[model samples]
Target chain A: MIEVNYKHKLNNFLLDISFTMPDKGITVLFGPSGSGKTSVLNLMSGLGNDKNKKINSRFIINDRVIDDSINRIKIQPWFRNIAYVFQDHRLFPHMTTKQNILFGYNRCNSELRPEVLIEKFKIKELLEHYPEQLSGGQKQRVSMVRALLSQPELLILDEPLASLDYTSRQELLPYIECIHKELDIPIIYVSHDIKEVLRLADYILIMDKGKIVDQGDIADLCISQPLLTQQEGASFILEARVTKIIEEDKLVQLDCGETILITAESMRLNDKIRVLIHARDVSLCLSPPQDSSILNCVPICVDEIQADENGKLRVIAKIGKQTIVSLISHRSARQLNIKKGKQMYAQFKATAMIK
Target chain B: MIELSPILVTLKLATITTLILLLIGTPLAWWLSNTSSKSKVVIESIVALPLVLPPTVLGFYLLLALSPDGFIGHFWLYISNTPLSFSFSGLVIGSVLYSMPFVVQPLQASFEMVGKPLQQAANTLGANSFDTFKNIVLPLSKRGFLVAITLGFAHTVGEFGVVLMIGGNIPEVTQVLSIIIYDHVEVLEYTQAHYYSIGLLVFSFIVLFVTYSFNRKLMVRL
Candidate 1:
């Protein structure tokens, strides 16, 4: 477990934040630019050392005190064993790719095998090349490997893919996901991109104006923080696994405990994924629809009915353990007599996003 | 033809001065590049004073400081039983201070050019400050080192005013190439003066050319 508490006056705002993360998972620090997201990362990693700026911080990772302002027990970044991947891939310009990766591996006395990461990140052929010779995405990959080989107790990635093009971001996402899957190293990924949060976050911390406004499981935060939706309104996420692939129809079937189908590509059998569903796309029916153009009509029970600020109504419903939301008119809510514990079916097209 | 001892003495003084300057200048330049303290400007101004100050003015103060009765000279005389003024050692001290900016400025600029990002990256990868400096900062600043060395060495070799003021023109000791050429011209020996003058001009050019060409070929990062 890693616990962080920081209070420092930045040029724009007062950065007061306190948060704890699990022993191992991707804990995202999501916020807009200048919201002190990077500042928090800097404090935790011992990178925010400006003698002019006063900071009172305490960071404890697994019962070990990494820093404490009151005690004056400040550790330097090198000895702290916290690795950071910057937005720009900060590979040493003078070193070859092999030397860059081995730099940390050698200095940290890391027991992790370098050959495995080099092969996994697919930089074997690029070993002899300098950072200038590689493409943007390739440089980032090498940087990730370099950070991982250091065997950090915590890995902080400050928008590692922000500088890449759309295709390069897509290409690099899996490599990041691979790190989460293969290693038990606790990672704090910072980003303002909604898609990245939905795809990569295991837990979410929504920061606003240097404060964590909301935080919880990604599925819960998705429904609560409208910013996580990437759309204009309320949204929810459905945890599902790939069950079947219909190549001829360009469709994929998912087992979200209800076997939902959506169109996507490049998925394997039994691969876990999250399906992002917008409340506006769903229309609630009192009973399962028999004749409709919609393919998904999952049965759900109304969890809550609240009036939206737009004079419409929002019906929060539960499908087994997972929750889905619906946006409908107040007139429709009255006609259906929508109330808590009311059984219904949600009808939405299969055009929902698959992550 | 030009009295070999003066040429030999000049090369020896320049070589020794440059080596000492590098050893002293690297840390000074590194501190100047990385520091954000209030004294940085003050220290920078002091280091740069020699660049604009007349060499004779610097030589004048150096002559006092190196004299047997002066503070630095008093302490040195008590320890080594030797006077700093009119000796090869005194000339070295003058040349080093005179050429301070040539070595330190280029090194500081190169170190600044390497930037803090790379050093931070090295730190996160478990490198202490000195380790990162040795492996990352030094290699990237190859051109800076080359320029500094060439300028330091050449500037020391061409020194005339400070050496003349402090050296007292002792043969086979402090009478360097520039002083020997001055001696020749003073005695109306224009031919001997021209020989040493042309040799110096060609030597300085060759040194600069080789250093720059090598610097370009080395693929320095900054």
Candidate 2:
């Protein structure tokens, strides 16, 4: 596990944040820009100083004190056994891909070699080339592979995909997911993109203005306080295991305790999928209408209703204990007398379910 | 038809001077580029002092400093029993001082352009200070180093007043191309003077041309 509780004051910004991340899977630090996401990473890597008196932190790899500020102990970045991949791929221009990958491996006390990592990252063909010869996505991939070659205990990535184009980001997303799944090492990824947080994060830490507002498992935290109500585009994260594939209809059946039919393309059987249903995309109805073109109409009981910024009412419906948000017009809500304990059907088009 | 011995001597002196300037100027320029210290102004003024001072004045000071009774001269005499005045090494030292600005200014500009991100990246990548300097700073500033070397060589070769004051025109020892041309001119030997001056001018032009072409290639690649 990685624990951090520190505070520092910059010229005009005050950064006081405390959070802990589990030792396995991807922990995403999600926030808007200028929310001290980068500063948190820098503090962990020893690039910035923490000036708090009670700053107790540790990255315990089997009970090792990698960082213990309370005891006045800290490990240098190089010896901390953590790899950081910055937003921009900081590839050394003087070195070839092979040399860049071998740089950390050369310093590591372990016996892992660069050739194995090169072949694993599929960069064997580009090993002799320089960073300038590759594209942005290729550079990021090489940097990731270079970071992993050291066999670090933890990996920190600060918006690694922000600089790439949309297509490049799409191309690299699966590779990041693969890294999280293939390696047993925990990862702390910082990003502003909610879709990436939903896709890759096992645990989410929501930060704003240098403070961690909330943090928990990705599924539970997505629908809770401050994350769902305060965030503009916040939605629910449903972890569904694929039960069957409806290949003829171009749909897949997912079971999150309730069978959900998603119009997802190119999915294999029994593959775990994460689906995000934005609050704005869902509507509530008193009864299931048969003449509707919507493919998803899950029976739910209205749990609560709250007014949004524009006075539009958002009704939280609980379908078998899974809370889903549905935005309804105030006039319709009033006419339908939608209130707490009202039975309703949460209706949404199958295409609105994004993975 | 012309004696090429002095031409060879000039080339040798300029080559050695340029080498020393590069070896010493790179770190100086890097420091100047990154340091926020108030002493930067003083150091810059000191480095640039040779540019504005008359060549004869600089040569006289150097001669005095390297004289048998002078401070550096007495120290050298005590250590090696030999003064540094009126020798090839003395000429090299004088040339480096005279052409110091040429070598340091380009390097400073290049170092400034290579911003902090590259260095910080190297620092976080398990590279120490010296390794970062060798790997990131040197390679990124290759064009500037080339420019400094070429300009320093050209500037040193064209030096006349300093060599005249200090070198004493010892043929095949300290007699460089510029001094050879000056000697011919003083004797009203216009043809020899013209030949030597033209050769020096052509050499400088070639160096500058190569510098510009290499810079162009760098721009294209970047």
- Model 1 clash tally, residue pairs: 0
Q: Is the docking of candidate 2 incorrect, acceptable, medium or high quality?
A: acceptable
lDDT of 2 by residue, B36-124 (tens): 77899899888888778899999999889877787777787789876778877778878989999888888887887776767766656
Residue A114's lDDT within candidate 1 is 96
lDDT of 2 by residue, A108-186 (tens): 7756666666766678889999999999998998999888877788889999999999999988888888787777889
Please name the candidate that would achieve the greatest TM-score relative to the true structure.
Answer: 1
TM-score of each: 0.91, 0.88
| CAPRI-style docking class of model 1 based on DockQ | medium
Q: DockQ each candidate and list the results.
A: 0.78, 0.39
Give fnat for candidates 1, 2 and onward, in order.
0.95, 0.37
